[model samples]
Target: MLLGRLRDPYINYRHRRLFHVLRVSIALTVTFAVVHLFPLEHSSWALVSTVMVMGNLPHIGGVLDKGRQRLLGTLVGAGIGLLLISLPIPGRGVQIGALVAIAIATWLVFSSRQAYAGLMFAISLLLVIGNGAPDFSVALWRSADVLIGTLIGIAATLVILPHKATDVLRFMLADNLDRLARLYHAHTSATSAPGVDTRELLKATSALLVKQRGLVDAVHREGRLSRGEVDELISYQRRMLSTIELLLESHWTTREGHDRINAMQGLRDQQHSLARDLGTLAFQVRTGQPISTDISPFELHSFAELAVGARGTDGRMLFSPSGYLWLNRELARVAASTAQRLASLERLPSKRLRRRAGRHGLHEAQRLDSKEGSQNDPGSH
Candidate 1:
């Protein structure tokens, strides 16, 4: 079971690592080919530039972002270079001052979200100053060569065995949801404290937030996603997480904590219901389609209610009519929900459909009766 849980991370790391190795190797090969096939006036400079740009491939998105920044910086720096060189600077000191001013301007302008743009600006500034701003023709040619190298670098970074941010987002959704389910079960079972792992959960939740946010930003940068399905998937994840937070806060409240065990009697049933919905949702996300089947909405709503109702009550009163049965039902719902989602992701048959054979009915009935009014309501019945 533990090994299964680690599967996603293991696969993701392997794929990314492989991609890094392959992409870097290919980029280096391309650089060698470029140096041998098309010799430049400064072949060493060309090779150095190629390596600098291609070296960034392992950090795809970051390299692209930096390139954009560098472009912006370069444009501003070039303009500043033109003005500084055009000025009536009589001595070598004044010329040096002008170059410094242009470089600083480029740095400042390119510093925005795109670091690469700043780099471009600085490089352009230095090149132009060193060449004494030779006819615009010469400066433009050097800039063009640099741009070509930058393009090759960016292309290498984005293309080789590229992984999508959406994949990470989906993985996180499943991982965190599974953890939340386990935590909820533990809290209700008295196997764990109400406040335990709240910090960890919060941290995981924040990480999800960051990934989701980045995914959206990425899609926007693409101008549009393939369709609305991805957006809908993101929205569903947000809703699922909101519901999870609600359940956690309800469970933690002192007022609800004591009575919570009982009020959450229906939790199991609710979990079952939640599992179905979560499964359907995850399927839609994975396949990039809308949910074709309807999910039982009441299960999640009821579980949420039960969680809230169980708050801040006395532990002894946990077996009362309003406590035990309600909580048990809620727990069943939660368990079912968890199981369903997990099954969907793993492509496994759900536990709900598996029936145990040849159990003694009388013994089961007796056990159920004995536990009917008990606080520690296990869901075996």
Candidate 2:
């Protein structure tokens, strides 16, 4: 009963949120325990470091990446801090000049890609110089605390219901492919309204493209996916998006003669066949199953012949089919290529599959529940 209740979508979302809070809390607690046991000076810094490093769930990769950056920054800052403290210019004016110079340099660094390191450098400089005399030991201790806290954050992420980047990437890829299938169905369906808003599909694809970049970065940080695999996934997604855009353009350009295309038995049959094939491939991807369909080349030659021979009531070409055949052929080719890539991906061994299986099981249970609900409804019957 507890498991069933946890599987409820609202309950699951709350649990996920709570899980993240627990992970951070545990990390902070551990950091504090160590600091108190060792009687470390400036222990508050360690707590701050842990809080900064512990990100939300399903982003272990991001947490580790930030931790690495924090360590690197701390080291660079400590070095700079020590050097500034050791300067031999004994006058107050010289000290002020050094401070001004360090501030300007740190500001420049903060604007660069190594902004974290730059900020750390500035902070360390201030901490070291805040004392009446320059103390190199202070800089060292601060860096050590930051490193320790970072390690603690990383440990918390790995120990707590660890979320792997690979699984998240797989889920996102499957969801995006399914969205593409829906867009394709809408575009190709004979019954779809001519004035249907296609921009929504384009907007969704564009958002997915942006998300793909972030996921790729996360995977790279986690060091789970090889360079080749990353390249292939990114390339495949781009091609799919391009094909979707082409299909949308074709639909819009041919809107004036949409009735004629729908009326033609061959074109209608081919369109439906292509849409079904796409949907099947999408399902295979979402379920991590090997794709087995051999999509026959869209009968482009026949389509061209019919398009050229057809005439309207005014005895003119029914539509400007200039790139219509090419677009259809390209969509089929891209879909086939995407399916082949997904099939290859599915054959790879995944360590996160067991964890993902639980999520998939919940999805199945929810589906069953919805089916039962509908069956029990008098309106549905």
Candidate 3:
């Protein structure tokens, strides 16, 4: 029973977090051992460098990028320190003034997104100028220590349970898609409980979008995803979110006439079919598999026909048929596009495949939307 109660925390612990902890522990241990064994000056600086470079749960790509930045920063900083030390500025006030100016410049660089280089510059300057007299030799030694620590951190990340940023990106995308599918179903289903909070679903989607930006940054830092791929993925996610918002709006507009609409056999069948397709697509995304069905277009343009044939014509449904058909068509397009995006990511090794996926996905969506629009209202086309 005691063990059973203790299981919750273990069960809740994320694999990513576990691996991150392990990676950091190993890197720090190795860094400490190296500093103690070697005749390196300022061994504590090495430890600090290792900690900074290792970061917390760094992706393989991020580790490499950070290491590179740290090394470059150290070299540049050392050079600057040496230059400053060699300068014949007679007064101590002038030297201090120069140091302060350099510090301000470093801060500006850091704020402008070149954080790694700027940080290194600052460190080098401080190390050389901190004493009563500037010491180029000490600055050089400190730079070497930083470089060594950075290399160790990079090696540990590469060799010890290395986590790929791309994998995290994939998992996050799949999870969000799954949630979106559920939200779509809930909004469209007439039988969904009154307690179902659409607001919460929207909030979750918004949060996922914010998370996606961070994931993209991580992937970029790791050097896994190219600019084109990142842009495509971001565009697809935004379109999907927009489509969901449209679906939610449709649901609210039709809620008052739910019984009458649900009573219609054709409309109900189409909604069910679309919901099933969305769920299947969600599953495919989660599993990193291609969707079996080639979601071609709204094969049935019967919404207008069905509405005209019905006996009792209500104002609530007057503009609703067109709106419903348009919304459904939009949903289908978004789903198909999303599926293609996933397939592209799956076969991401080939640049040609990615290009084709984007081209074909957009073409297919446009064709479907055009066909539906022309069929529903010929003038709009």
lDDT, each prediction? 0.49, 0.64, 0.63
Tens-digit lDDT track of model 1 for 6-124 = 22322433366676667667766776677678744444544455566655334444455555654565566666666666666666753586557756755665634454566666677
Writing each residue's lDDT as its tens digit, candidate 2 over 187-292 gives 6664453444668766776786676676665567777575478668767777877877777775433454655454445664565566666655554444444567
lDDT rank order:
2, 3, 1
Mind giving the per-residue lDDT tens digits that candidate 3 earns over 1-381?
A: 433322221121236677678889898999888988888888788888888988874577667767777787777767766676777767685367547757776767865546877777767666766653666667778878888888888898877766666656655665666566566666655556355577887787678777667666557775657656776776776777787787677653444444445545555445555555655554444333454544545544445565444333354334555555676677778777766655655443423222333322534643563353234331223
Best by lDDT: 2
lDDT-better candidate, 1 vs 2 = 2
Report the CA-based lDDT of candidate 1 relative to the real structure.
Answer: 0.49
| Model 3 / residue 134 / CA error / Å | 3.0
Better of 1 and 2 by TM-score: 2
TM match of model 1 to true structure: 0.57
Residue 303 lDDT in candidate 3: 51
